[model samples]
Target chain A: TQLLEQSPQFLSIQEGENLTVYCNSSSVFSSLQWYRQEPGEGPVLLVTVVTGGEVKKLKRLTFQFGDARKDSSLHITAAQPGDTGLYLCAGASEAAGNKLTFGGGTRVLVKP
Target chain B: EPEVTQTPSHQVTQMGQEVILRCVPISNHLYFYWYRQILGQKVEFLVSFYNNEISEKSEIFDDQFSVERPDGSNFTLKIRSTKLEDSAMYFCASSRDSGLQAFFGQGTRLTVV
Candidate 1:
């Protein structure tokens, strides 16, 4: 079983502050996706990183896939209250039939 | 934009009773999946369905759990018997393909007593 581990399980930061969430795994994946979920709701996909050493930016949010495709990261610039949510990283491995294995998740609370 | 929709936002049931959760995936999506998240836990994959049958399932999807795409647009998950541990937020998702991003429904919160 491939396991994804996230760092800083819980984070509380003031609005306008920057934060980075990390997702790491020992197994290689074909793709990595970041999702944000609020209470009482399902996760919303934020971004998908496919190629190794690839970086994609979505306005203030930047996502990166590691060179080995075994790790990924999300960096939020000037965080806002609206960004507060549970951030999850899921890895899809072709070896595992392209099934997704999600990380433990990071709870971010942006305080204004 | 199109989205996945789930029915019965919240369900409270007895431990031994059966429960059926429903979902309407995106009109054009071909892949469908069911996932659950116990409170304070990570989301866990249950099963994946396609071509009117199951394509994949996780260890958590045992004999008591089954999935059916009864109609062209509707997908359903049935739990033969509920257990206290079954209480969680059940989410239905769909994607155009296995490598694409999956769109998730709001989810059905199941509370078993």
Candidate 2:
């Protein structure tokens, strides 16, 4: 089974502090997606990385995909209270037939 | 923006009872998926549907679980016999094509007592 494991299941930080969450796996994927979920709601897509060693930035959040497609990371600069949520990483592979394998998620709490 | 929509934000059903979860995917999307997250657990894929048929399913999707696209816009998941373990937040997602960014609905919280 393809498994994506996220480190630091929970994180707490003061506002303006930076935080980084990592997703690692032994199985290679075709693409990796990052999502943030609020309590009682479904996950909202944040970014998707397809190319190896690619990096994308969205304002305060930066996403990086490993060259082997086996890992990814999300780095938040100057995290605000609004950035607090459950961050999840999911991997997609053609062999999986459109199904996404999700990580356990990292719950971040930014205190104001 | 176009997004997936799910009906009945919360559902409460008894064990062994039948429950059907409904979802309407984006009009332009062709692939639909069902995923669930047990409390404090990772989100797990249940099934993926395309072209009016099931493209893939996880082991969690057993005989009691079934998916159908009865119409052009509506996609539904039926649990013939619900169990307490089935209580979780069920999310519906859709994408324009395979391996693309899939948009998700707010989700339906299913509680099986």
Candidate 3:
């Protein structure tokens, strides 16, 4: 079974603090996507990394895919209260028919 | 901006009863998928549909569960017999093609009593 594990299942930080969430897997992926979900809502796509070692930035959020395409990370710089939510990492692999295999989510709480 | 939409934000059904969850994927998308998330658990892929047939499915998608695109626009998932374990947040998603970004619906929360 292909499994993606995320670290720091829960994070609590004050506003203006920075945090990073990591997703790792033993199997290589064709693409990795980051999503943020609010309570009672479906996940909202934040970014997708297709190439190994690729890096993409969205405002204060920075996402990176590992060189082997088996790991990824999300770094939030100077996070604000609005950044508080459940962040999830999902991977798509050709071996898995390109279906997304999701990792356990990281719940972030940024308090003002 | 286009988005996937699901009907009946919440549904409550008794065990052994049947339930149908509906979804309207983004108008232009060609690939449709179903996923579920048990409380406090990771989101898991259930099935993928394309060109009027199932392309892939997980073990969790047993014969008891089925999907259909009855019309060109609406996709539906049917559970022949629901069990207490079937209660979860069911999300519908779609993508323009394979390996692309898949947009998701708000999701239908199914509660099996």
Q: Which candidate is the best by lDDT?
A: 3
Cα lDDT of model 2 by residue, B22-107, tens digit: 99999999999999999988899999998888889999999999999998999999999899999999999999979679889999
Candidate 3 per-residue lDDT, tens place, A1-112, comes to: 8999999899999999999999999999999999999887899998989999999999999999999999999999999999989999999998999899999999999999
TM-score of each: 0.97, 0.98, 0.98
Residue pairs clashing, model 1: none
What tens-digit string does per-residue lDDT give for candidate 2 at A42-94? 89999999999999999999999999999999999999999989999999999
**CA lDDT, candidate 1, residue A12:** 99
TM-score ranking, high to low: 3, 2, 1
Please give the range of 10 consecutive residues that has the lowest summed lDDT in model 2 chain B.
B95-104
lDDT of 3 at A63: 97
Residue pair clashes in candidate 3: none
- Please write out the lDDT profile of model 1 over residues B1-21, one tens digit for every residue: 899999999999999999999
- Tens digits of lDDT, candidate 3, B1-113: 99999989999999999999999999999999999999888999999999999999999999999999999999999998899999999999999978679888999999999
Which 10-residue span in candidate 3 chain A carries the lowest summed lDDT?
Answer: A37-46
